[model samples]
Target: MDAISLCEQYAAEHGMQQKNGNAPWRLFFRKEIFSPWHDAREDPIGTDLIYQQVLHGIKSGEYKCDKEEELASLIAQLYYVEEGPLEVNHLENQIYKYLPIFELKKNKLANEYWTGSIMYQYRRQFGVNPPDVHHVKESVVSFAKCRWPLLFSRLGKPSRNTCTIQTVSGDEYYIKSFNSQKIEYLILAFLNGLKQRSRFVIARKNQCGDDSNDLLDFEVGDLLELINGVCGKELLTETLVRGENTKTCLQGFIQSENVYVLPALIKPNANVMIYADNRNDFNRSQEATAYPQWRFGRDVLDMPLLKKLEGRKEQCNDAMTMFMFIMKYMGDHPSRRNRLSTDITDVIFKPAIAHEILRDELYCQLLRQITMNPSVTSEEKGWELIWLATGLLAPSPYLLKEVVQFLNSHQHPIAFDCLNRLKKLNKGCSRKFPPHFVEIEAIQNRTMQILHRVYFPDETNEAIEVESSTKARDLVCQIAKRLRLRNKDGFSLFVKVREKVLAIPETEYFFDFIRNLSDWAQNINVENSMLQINYQVFFMRKLWIDVKPGDDTNADLIFHYYQYLPALKPISRRTFGEEAENGNLPSHIKNLHMIRKPLTKYFQCEIAK
Candidate 1:
């Protein structure tokens, strides 16, 4: 018959209906048959023709099998045929001559989908009792032994057809087969689980082992212990059984094949069953517990900078380059000035790495820029720079000094903010300041006073120089001696400078006196007397005070002259007395006092000569 007629006959016998001419169904049918024909016109045989040829070839003895009955059964199974099996002993004998046993086994396993379909059909047709569960389990175990000898041996024996495998390091797995047909499925599932959930192991050889106790001999049956993670292969594995009791754990990779599922002789424990679920969590907990205990125990100063920078070369270089770029960009872009500020306060100036960055001159320059940029400078950034500079005080004194000087002149709030920072930096630093630093401190004190006036106007208006009561007392004593006050007891020294009267207590130190004096000096209505006291008591201590007789007033007129001036050239007394009486002396020096005799003895002697 023609191929089309043959297909019609087969369909009639099977009571099969043809599918509609849908593209999907046609495509699916062509794909299922593995047809080479791409289109209806390419090869007229098409999908239906191919199916007909295969069935006809089988029936006509063109195809052969080892067992005619089995071949017929398989063919009928594939075609959904309902008929007695074909008999062909001669074909069966011929087939066996060419196919080996191993090939047969491989082919059977390879056609798993067909085998599954046949089994389903058999169950539907014969209503077979579930193959003896015990027999199926035995078959699976036997297959496991052949396929995975090492893994099977580790499983001592099966309990209720279930196996529990425990590695020497305490990892556990359970394998069970309750149904016959699912044995291969269960084994496959277990293998997949093993691959997904396996942990790494490292092994090292035992040095004391004799020639007889070779490394290979330290196999599954040997005892082993777990240790810290190590790098390398062939090291002892945590799960390896050791031949002898020793303190060391083997370090190495445990071959998955070497792992076995021993038959569970008893029911599995709850903990063993829950192992898979909690293994990762338990591992994380172990790492968390162990990490803090592992200390490098090396001093920071002892660590070589080059060695520390070895693996971090790229990261450190990138960070430094990026920081420089940001600074350069900030300088050009005034509107985005705060970008540099944010970087210092939020990133570079962190306590952990701030010192490291400060050690670099380039980074110090960036810090200086951030501190001085009025548009972008903030109290926080200023403090951060101060902190970094303070740390650099010992290693880079010049850089620290530059940073302080820059901050001292900065109009930003940081100008004031760095005062406390420097104080703290200086504390406990034991290092002596360079001569220039004393001047720097004076400048800082003056800057702090200005900042105090601008930002903290309401803050207790006190003098920056007045730090202690002793300094305040010293200042008062100087004023007393200058005024020749013999009755110094119970007499308060009232300083009239501008509109403010600073009552200097006798017990007050020089610091308090200067502080109060500074406040008094800042008054808008300051008098000439106050300006004179400010210059002489706080400043012109070494200068000569020239006392000239006044033309109109009985009081002598005092004028501050250079200490280096010769007494012979002493100011013409006649000229200064008339000027003092007319109140023509500069307002700044108008309130000068008569020279104390003993202090001005040199000038007096010069005048006498």
Candidate 2:
């Protein structure tokens, strides 16, 4: 029989009904039984196992009890259906909410597994939602994919066994399904445990020594003792203090019944050590370490505290100590020495400390420190040294000599840049360059030559001579004559520029024609410049009529024609007789007139004959 018929038979025997007075098995059969069964058929073992479990439960009289018992029996039958043998130890109490088994031994085994196995910790960490269980399973699968590729590869295959025996290097390691399942449970537990440990440590570190409310408690910026993980003890300045009521710690606060103290000190733990007391000093040290060649100028080093602690030896010791440390660091490298020289001009060589630190001995020592470094200098390092030398408070003769010597020895782009700047400074200000910088001047000259060559080509030097006196009327006449000869029929001539055509007006004067041509050329190129012209001819049909002998004597019988001719058109003529009177007609048309004269002579000769 079909799944629905079998479900209805079972429901009738078990007295099941729906709220609408229909059979409950009608809906349940479609959704729960038939759908699951159809989907499970895709796997070869699923359908057979489910059918065998359902039949076994019915034959064993497990579903012969009340409604709850029947439901539980059915669920348990479905839950235990799988490819491998059901391990009672692996099924914990979490699964029993759906598969309500009444067997005492199975229930007790599930309780033991829940309390003792890592599944209990997993549930405590992430809750017992179905999605949480899926998350744990996914995490396990991902871990296995990364750590053990061979084992994970067998998981989804239908024919693969859950348990396997393998020999590796003359040894046998037992691989079982239970081990993989157990590991899936333990990963979440370990992560949750580590999270709790970190919270506890942070809590203990923030507790104050005094319990009295009147005492001035420690705030951010208070100096305190920090226990370093590698080093023993170090002093640290607090940068931030987070309260217990803050959102990040709110859960812990509520869980502890709000007994956790307020205003927890948030300091960098054992990983970082802060040696300086003030922010400026700390920042300076950090910057010096990160970019060792960066120079902080007088504007930066002119702190208010420097003036207050000028003569006080004890109070200024920290500043002096940091300076000495920076100096020592700078001395260790050539680039650092360059930066140090610039920095000292701002901090130590100021007017206040001029006598103390910027003496003749110190000046010589600094010059030696800058020039004595044997490291091969690159272009960038050469520029840095030049910057160091240029920023000195009073340009000493020895210092300038040493800078010029360095520039001479290191001839590069950077040296050239420095030389150009120095030359400009000498012209604009009191600074002067030594006589040994002839190579720098030569480099500048050569650079100018290259730039001139690159920007100016030979063809651009020759001027294009355009005749400015060419009249526009002459050009228009030339264009019209050319168009008339090319197109012998009645046609109009136009000058085509881009999409538009310029038609020659019949009464246009010479100046107007010149202006229009100039406007056209200006639109094409620039004003009053010569423009290339393109001409167009539009042809029209002509109907010529001969004049009779009694026509007016002033008429010359030459008629211009149009494309659209009227049915009865009047014949009128404009004068071409002026060309005949002046004998200006071309030789070919004049020869035709000469032939007419000869024909009249022939007629006279015939009459005589």
lDDT of 1 by residue, 1-609 (tens): 365566666666776645752112122231121211123334433424444433444455444455533453444333333222322443333333322334346664534433443444444533544343333323322332243334222222333565455453477776664542244345444543432332222112223344443332233223233224321111212223322221244333332123322223223345543553344222212443365222111111222222334455554564554344334333322333423223332333232233343344333434534431222223233344443344323334555566566556444454555545455545433212111221224333444221111001112222323221123344445443544533223323344444554454545433334444554454544553223233222221232234332321211112223332334344545547677678876642554334333324555455556
TM-score of 1: 0.16
Give every collision pair in model 2: none
lDDT per residue for candidate 2 within 420-518, as digits (tens), equals: 444443332221111111122333243311111100011121111111111223333443343333323222223444566465443333223433453
Error of 1 at 475 (Å): 57
> lDDT of each prediction vs. the true structure?
0.36, 0.33
- Predicted structure with the largest lDDT when compared to the true one: 1
**TM-scores vs. true structure, each candidate:** 0.16, 0.16
Off by over 4 Å in 1: 1-301, 304-349, 352-609
Residue ranges of candidate 2 with Cα displaced over 4 Å: 1-136, 139-238, 243-609
Error of 2 at 502 (Å): 58
